[model samples]
Target: MIPHIHRRTFGTGSRPVLAIHCSLAHSGAWRGVGAALSDIATLHAYDLPNHGKSGDWDGQGVMHDTATDMALAVLDEIGPVDVIGHSFGATVALRLAIEHPMRICSTILFEPVYFAPLMADDPGFAGGYRHDTAAYDQALEAGDTAAAAKAFNSTWGDTAAWDTLPEASRTYMAERIHFVRDSAPFLMNDSADLLAPGRFAQATGPVLLMRGETSPWAEDLNGAIARRLPNVQEVSLPDLGHMAPITHPDRVATHVRSFWAAQGQGLRSARL
Candidate 1:
């Protein structure tokens, strides 16, 4: 059975946009962006299973199962709608758009950590990835949760950012490291066509891909995915990094709202 998903709704606009947050984050991550776009869209921000108010998912950590639950949640609560997601959530959004094409009208992804295609594109990348994973595994094996998180965060976000986290926040992230670690296989090792070059023909929708200028890895991944998408627009935010969604909502929201505005027009034309 699919588990119940916890969500927070914002705005009263007729058009709905479902916003999914990245790992280590909850629906609140969308608060600022949602508020900014509220004038044009009714945003439904959800907490992924085991993230915030959500309960444990009955299914295993397989990403497709999680995507199924997420798709169902959209069907049950909001029906087919446009979507916005970041990092891990952005990866799931890719699956939903690919597997359930009719359900997602449009998509906006920020730094989607879909690494499988990258590995496929460059075999040498795997060596570096393996080396990093080795370090992360070693820290975990040594029962050094802090070290593990530091290693993980340093790669995804920034090493210095981990030290800047508050003690309580660091503790919370350390506790949930297992979920983060378990998702790596699905993100980086999956063999699905969604991760293949030029395999986005199945995802029939307008797509907006956003990346921070300072985030090289994410930018490269986004670029690779963009090349395959049937319909896509790419944007790079100057002086921003992987955590732009959390740290610079106003700027992020500006780009998102612009996309939705264009999408809203398309929706209206379709209704005519």
Candidate 2:
């Protein structure tokens, strides 16, 4: 069954861009970045299943595949577009660029949580990541979803304190925390086979891989992905973390603009 995806558009620009938010976040999460890029791109973001107003995942197939299909539906409607994604969404964006290169002109990936590279190239970092998230894993095992959510957020979320977040935000994260676990097969194990020999070469267009300097695992992971791509530029944002796109949208947008400019796509005035 096709999940009913809820989409939101931002910006008034000639370029069509699909924005995919991180896990546990809805399409609204792109508002800040979208506004920042209003002059150059129109962002079409969608709520993944079980997020925002979208219907729940029916558990019939791989959740990552389902999410990718939902994003593909949006791509089909919009025609060729540049893609931007954060965290888990970045993984989906990468998949789209690899599998549907003709439909994607470029891709900007922010802190994609594809850990398979770490396991292969830097087992120590992968082991450390597992150790760091052991508490979250234990909480999930114990059926303490709230605790798991807190643990997960503390590690990957912006510098905000869990207790400082609104009660509603906490509840929202807790309700969707299982997605973190459910995504393990793809993120940790690379169930999608995205790293298969010659797969990264499929994306022939320019690829911008950005990550926060403060993110413990981002540099190594992005490095692994960058090494595989043919035309790739890697940037590390100073003082930013995994959620830089949300907490520091303007800074992130600056890099996005620079990347496009480097590719000879200059910014244009927003469409009326």
Output the worst ten-in-a-row residue range by lDDT, candidate 1.
263-272
Report residue 91 deviation for candidate 2 (angstroms). Answer: 0.4
The global C-alpha lDDT for each of the candidates, from Candidate 1 onward, is 0.78, 0.89
Give the clashing residue pairs of candidate 2, or none: none
- Alpha-carbon RMSD, each predicted model: 2.5, 3.0
List runs of model 2 lying over 4 Å from the truth. Answer: 265-272
User: Which stretches of candidate 1 lie above 4 Å from their native place?
Assistant: 58-61, 132-134, 158-160, 191-193, 196-199, 268-272
**After TM-score superposition, what is the CA distance of residue 39 in candidate 1 from its true location, in Å?**
1.0
Total backbone collisions for each predicted model: 0, 0
lDDT of 1 by residue, 1-272 (tens): 65667888877777788888888778898887777777778878888877788776654657546754765677566777888889988887877778777778888899988888788778898788677678778988898888887777877664358879889877866876766766767777873556554457888788899999888577679877887788898999999989888888889989987887777677534522
Query: lDDT by residue for model 2 over 19-122, one digit each (tens)?
Result: 99998889999999999999988999999888998888888768898899999999879988889999999999998989998788889999898888768787
lDDT of 2 at 100: 90
Candidate closest to the true structure, highest lDDT:
2
